[model samples]
Target: MVYDKVIEIIKEEFDVDEVNENTLLREDLGTDSIGLLELVMAIEEEFDIEIEDANLDDIKTVKDVVDSIEKIKG
Candidate 1:
């Protein structure tokens, strides 16, 4: 459930259509720092959870976001 919604959020935020678990946000989607911050904000609002600033550095792919959301929601 989280993965699907996350994919939607990412697609909307990045305006990309080909997003998957292994898709790299930076190398593949060309997501910059500001774009990442915006993505995180959207994810937080969608899930109603807080993602720490420190953890943002570890997010490299779509799966990472899904994992973070699952961990936070758990």
Candidate 2:
């Protein structure tokens, strides 16, 4: 559920048609620093959860985002 929502958010935010768990936020998705920040904002809004600034550095892929959400929601 979270993964699906995250994928949807990524697609809408980055305007990309293809994405998966392994897709890198920067390389595979072409997300610049600003885009990444925007994506994080969108994710925070979508999931209604707060992601720490410190944890942002650890998020490099789709799965990482999903894991972050799950960990925070826990």
Scored by lDDT, the top model is 1
TM-score versus the correct structure, for each prediction: 0.98, 0.96
C-alpha RMSD (angstroms) for model 1: 0.5
Model 1 lDDT per residue over 10-52, tens place = 9999888999999999999999999999999999999999999
Candidate 1 — which residues are off by over 4 angstroms? none
lDDT score, candidate 1? 0.96
Q: Give each prediction's root-mean-square deviation over alpha carbons.
A: 0.5, 0.6
Q: Give lDDT: candidate 2, residue 13.
A: 92
Candidate 2 residue-wise lDDT at 1: 98
TM-score for predicted model 2 compared with the true structure: 0.96
Question: Where is model 2 more than 4 Å wrong at Cα?
Answer: none
Model 2 has how many clashing residue pairs? 0
Worst 10 residues of 1 by lDDT: 10-19
| Local error of candidate 1 at residue 16 (angstroms) | 0.8
Model 1 lDDT at residue 4:
97
TM-score of predicted structure 1: 0.98
